[model samples]
Target: MAPNRGRPKNLYQFHYGCQLFPTETRTQKQLRLALQARTQAETGPTLRRNLNRSNRSVKAAEEPTPSHPQTGTEQHDVLGFNEGPSLWEDTEEILNEEDEVSRARLRSLHQEMIEQQRHRNWKDVMACLFPAYLHFKKLTSNWTVPNPFLNLSSEVCACPVEAYKERDVDLIDLMVAAIDVYQSLKSKERKLTQEVTSTDQQDVLAQQSCPACFGVSIPNNDSTEPASEPADNHQVFICLDGNFQHRHHERASKNYIGIENQTLFVPSQDIESSNSEIREAELAKRVTKKAKDRCAEQHKAADDRRNASTWKGCDDTGLFGCCCRHDSVIAFCNIHKTGEGRGLPMSIIKRLLNSINPNVQVGVLYDIGCTLGKFFKARGLLTNHLLRLKFATAVFHSYVHDWPCQLQFNPRYNNGWGLTDGEGLERLWSYLLPLVSPLRYATRNHRISAINHRSLFHNTLGIENIVLTLKRKFIHALKTKKESEGIVHQFLQDQNPHERGQKYTVEFFRAQWQKQRKFEIEISQTNREKKAEQAQFYKRGEALKSLVETLMDSLAASPQSDPAQSLSLIQQMQELQKLQDEEAAKLGSLFVVEPGAERD
Candidate 1:
């Protein structure tokens, strides 16, 4: 019998395991065309039906007929052919044609399936089976060879059995080899794809030219400058806002128009002026011509100076000290430069200054707010000439006094203090009175009473209202002092003169005052404690002096003793001195007796 040359059993097998994997071979362009044709065919019939229905009479009058001779011939040939199976001929021609077509379609489908199966097998072997086989070989090679069932190709019947039996190595080494092959293949594919895509893109770009360059034609001229080098600033004038002369006119004019204002001009002679007088006159004219320009330069310079001063003073006194008299005065003026010209109130200025220098002690000699000025004036009446002279000297000595106290007093100078009201005002007054009195006059006398009076006054009557009332009252009282004196006299007369005013002479006054008054009780508890500490300190000093004398006597008497023993004695003396120092510190006194005594 002839050897069976049939397909393998695996090929005929149902493959109930799963369907064959499909391969990606269809071109995107072909699929897209097929989809478009199907959509058009479906829609065309509906469109034609609608057209015929809309014009039924016209369609009936124009009968349909074949346009070409082959159209009718083709129809007749199709109808004349055999339609069914014939017993005599042993074959149905129509059936045979149908079978042939069916066979051709089956053949095409089988080819597609085989290609898909081959691709799937290649991927599975490369990605899954090969890696697994390599891993098994690496682990098993060190031991006795494993069974032949471990051979993946033999089990899958995908690759030759001889290939499966090939010796294995480390999985990583095998994986590296596979990876190198994959990378090479992938690189080639990418290069080809990129070449095709880039070519297509370049063609597209070449076909679509730039509209501007395309619409306008210019003859080639060697005289023309290269496009990369733009026209000089004088030649090219571009008005971004669009209302201006063209490029040619712009080059001729050599001056670009500015918004609202025309291009400024300076005569060549004015620019070339060499004489000092001419230069000075030109400079003055330039400044006078544009006040804004001159003012801006001056303002910028002033700001730079102020900033330099601020940096210089930050280490010594902080930024507040850098403020100039003009700044304070301007702040005080309350003049709204940019808006409505309304001056700020004097009280507002005071609040502003206090806010700016809340922690610093500022003298009141410089302009302070009106209320503070009046308060200072009132205190000045009580102050003696000697105190005033000292105050004047102190003000001269320290430049802190030169600062504009009045302008600094404004709340506007302080960050975020302008909106403070009654409670905030009271707190500010309390804080400022103490700060001001300490630094202002340099007087030995305590201004506690004066500070308290001002604080209480501001607290009870608002600062502005108090100044207003005082002004009104002072004028009225000056005009009518006799009436005020009478009221005062009546009150004074009502009290007994002996009880109202008691006079004491020196010697007898001291005896009576000392005897009648409880002086000891008047002494502070802290003072009593200090006195006790002094007594204890004296006792400790006596004890320490005795101990030191004994140590010195011992050392002098034992001069022949071992030097080491003598040194040890001296160390003990030093330790005692240290103990004395620690004790003295507890009592708030230095242990040293002499002012410049050397401590050992």
Candidate 2:
């Protein structure tokens, strides 16, 4: 706690009897206890085998030191053949594609590639140290931390075998490469298992998609819900949004290897193509300079300022991600040196459409769905695919749009959205928040690979919990439907019948919605002066309402206040009264006399 010394106060408390062996630090003690617990949790036979070996899985309790590192001779070397599943025969290789090769050599080659990549860029700066845990626990069955490959330079720090060639972090990065390979092989094995039980043809969408959202293969014991329904359940709803937190600083890393073009991401070239299209439209005078509404203009200006200025030193501005309704990542693309353009989401939608079955309905919900829908329809882009797709703004975000936009594009007002709020990708961004800082300095390939890995893990978890997710969603929808129907019924009952004995039925409200939509669309197109006048009226009305609410809040904020705070509150009320008087003057002497004026 001392400022100048800035060291733990308890550092000198521990005393050792002798220095024959290096004493365990806090980290080592914790790790040893963790490993010892794991050893105890194992079966009795495995525990006996581990106990027989002097250096076994629980070796962290007593790591070999720099003075006398552990060594293996042919006489004492631990050797065994752990047979891999026959399905590994078809799994893809890291860099090698040659078949019928030794698995050990393939592993060696993979490790070599990981080392080369590590040394080339992240040798010192960004190498991942040996993490506290591995990605997959299955690998831990045969894993040992105190292996000969790792050198315990001290109780605290670790180095690799080649005499300080790599730090513990580098060893961790090396291990990630092995994990990546292991994960791929396990996925292949899983897909083979699915093949035995599944009847339908398999593809990326069919395999990776959530069973609840798309359709389950196995029967739901509940029995009422359909499992053998059409692919994508007749409609595919996706959430699209931009996140600037996952940007990369240009000065942090330098590599021309280009980002990996994989299933998890849309290629940079494809997104760049959309950007080019936007620029060309502007040049050709096909794009309008006028914004659709004040909200649209404000949103665009804010985006422009954020993307252009906030990340001047960064090459990647952010990311544009698309996720299915069940929060499974469909695809995402990196935004390069620019704010999100119309090109990004449009390109991603085109990509999604091209991937899914053509006949199925596709609903895309984004933050600015109304504006994007207009832009798409005006440009006549994606002509062949547009017929089957519809656009809606996300439920929470729709309020940010003008009333007209909300009426046209908000899922709450529109049909077919079904309680789908379209905020799934926001949850995804929260999942990637931890990667934000590290990825800003990571190599481009590593950044993409890391995101892909995280997304894969998230999707795997989504698949595992999909049935529960569907059950929850169904319950929520049913509850909401009942409450809404009751409220509507009560409202209808409360409405008085007209002189002609005509009731204000649900059909009447539907007709009113249609009429209001038509009037708003017409007014938006033709009445600029009227729109401005109406905006001012709404602004003044909101000000008055806000002033009333503020006064009420301030009155209740401190019912038992002191004299000085009481004086402050009185002055605040006077200021509010003065503003109200000014607003009244703007209303052309609506009040009898000037309010809040001096009595004299």
Listed in order, each prediction's TM-score against the native is 0.14, 0.58
The residue ranges of model 1 lying beyond 4 angstroms of the native Cα positions read: 1-463, 467-600
Model 2 earns a TM-score of 0.58
* TM-score result, candidate 1: 0.14
Per-candidate local distance difference test: 0.35, 0.68
Once superposed on the true structure, which residue ranges of model 2 sit more than 4 Å away at CA? 1-202, 214-233, 278-285, 288-295, 495-497, 500-503, 525-531, 534-600
What is the C-alpha local distance difference test score of candidate 2? 0.68
Candidate with maximal TM-score: 2
